[model samples]
Target: MAILDIFVNFIQVSMPRSNVIILTDPASQFSMEKSSTTVLPIQGDYSRGNLMLQRIMSYITFLEQRLKEHPERLKCINHYIFTDSDIALVGNLGQIFEKYHDFHLALTFRNNKDQPLNSGFIAVRGTSDGILRAKAFLQEVLEVYSTKYMKASRMLGDQLALAWVVKSHLTFATKKFSRPEAFSGDINGKLVLFLPCLIYNWTPPEGAGQFHGMPLDVQVVHFKGSRKRLMLESWNLFNSTSNLSDMLCLILGSGRTKYDF
Candidate 1:
């Protein structure tokens, strides 16, 4: 099976039973409207391959309407939004949410300094304040890009806009956002929480196992680059054996799953 097929199956099977919504393009072949899982339709102009920004905006708009309609059911609940490319390695989502429950918004960091925040995986509490802030952030990003000063690039898309929003609103001076337990200090008005990249959004170089060593605590593996074949090979190798050592050996021995970035 294709890597994307595997990814979809993983999401469909392992998704938490909470109110989970999968946002997809209107033209997509996959659509599920059921009790636990709801596949919402989103339409956007494909400009320079930056349709992700439009899809994200559509999701936020949908959430805003839902919040207006069902205010009581969404109270204090956690809403996790992930891209289609992200794969779930661990199944205990409640534990992860409990670990970062103090913050209104939780985002994973990209592997490098160039793209510090990866909007691919975002978790937001269902509180009124949390939803409001998240909606404001997304709206402001779109507004900024629409203005004359900022020109949106196809290479980065929503990632650049998100970074600008966080930097403009939040303060990262103290170690509060970086360390989970150090959140006792006053945030000085910042509502965003930065999760450890290794645990939440393990990427190529570190997650490939042979390169930087895959830590035992990796919860999600994000395949950001364009190489789908290698990602599938890696996923298959990781799931082929029960022993971690054997898995690593099988992955390293094949030499076909080497990640480029």
Candidate 2:
């Protein structure tokens, strides 16, 4: 869980203006009181490829219900995001939202054709239509999973399902990912934007070294697969912590759990 400490450090330093919501199962090992972010207990199996869809649907539903209950809250927020815990924010996320203010749903893409998109990082504008479009698009992904990917969706996790929807429904205006511009598109009638993984969802390269690090411009580092240790490594490389024990105090808030994943 030291990685979580590092995660919190990054947020507190780089994106202090942002809020984090951590959805966990009953068996999670994170301590809510020790954590600086909101730790929400969710009812579901935390395994991949389950009917819970890795709680993607649950998060979206939670936001939907919250806004329905407090309609005015929507006008006050600028952007809302959903991301996996295995990530570290390194750049100012607000800058991206400020520049691409028109997008309803923003997703990140990888180089692989088989798995072109990674669903770990998702950004939704806070505008009424933006939220509505995100809900509509994500809900449609559920339908697409059942109708298109079927068993494969469960086996490969939600990324496959999400990619299926993007390919089958959206029409892209630009395809280049290294142009410093978004791969803007339209899904049905809603606006969608695709950001390169190198910029927003960076993962380790095949032959990356122990000291490997991302480019200075990368907004986030997604510690996908078994690279969670790299998060702590990178954090230490960038920031000097004199008292490791004291710094670990600013962790995910109050309760204990059975497992870390």
Candidate 3:
């Protein structure tokens, strides 16, 4: 069994639950969701807009609780996959796992000046020591992210902390999957590739592009804003291929198995 987790902050006006559902629906094949699947809504003193680092830290804290509560779930799972709510799945991720059995951990490297790797898509699977290292890194992040007074700090929060810690602990088998040319699926038959276009189509500052012409192909459109508008738009234009309807229905409809905190 493999476990996958996604963190969605309730505070972000962009990429609301509706948008996230639309992005994920097409990728979902299992009639039954994973045993430990969950979305944690975190409410803290985080500011709006440039609070991504803070949100990530908060989500890390949330994961601490999830791990504590569901240790059994982790034991059954061979690999743990994490993707941002905004990212959509297009290709066969499960197939990638089958192809890349040797890789215990994987991530997409971001193109920062330091060329820091992106934490948006993360996979971890290995001995208990590896898990311990991941947790220790989280702890270290908490230490550096907080002030003596508990206010958030800007010191390379989640991405940097993760890059540094994971580098120390596990071996990264692939580069960041930001573009298709950089993606080489030859890693033990497993694949970890980024896209030039949006697998998770984030709303552009300009406007939506013509989905038909885009080359690399998009798995999911990560709409940071206009979730409702997009849903309504999807409803109005229901082509057989449109995933918007499915996503909107999931969000507008409800009956999730409520877990007791």
Most accurate candidate by lDDT: 2
Candidate 3 segments exceeding 4 Å error: 1-44, 49-51, 66-73, 103-105, 112-116, 126-131, 140-221, 224-261
User: Which ranges in model 2 have alpha carbons more than 4 Å from their true place?
Assistant: 27-30, 34-36, 48-52, 153-155, 171-180, 208-214, 241-261
lDDT of 1 by residue, 38-87 (tens): 67776665454567656567757766875686666776466655554545
> What is each predicted model's overall lDDT from 0 to 1?
0.58, 0.68, 0.40
Candidate order by lDDT, decreasing, is: 2, 1, 3
RMSD per candidate (Å) reads 4.4, 7.0, 11.9
Task: Tell me the TM-score of each prediction against the true structure.
Answer: 0.75, 0.80, 0.46
lDDT by residue (tens digit), candidate 3, 18-59 = 222112222234332423334344555455432545555554
Question: How far does residue 62 in candidate 2 sit from its true spot (Å)?
Answer: 2.3
Window of ten residues with lowest summed lDDT in model 2 = 250-259
**Models ranked on TM-score:** 2, 1, 3
Q: For candidate 3, what is the TM-score?
A: 0.46
Superposition TM-score, candidate 2 onto the true structure: 0.80
- Total residue pair clashes for candidate 2: 13
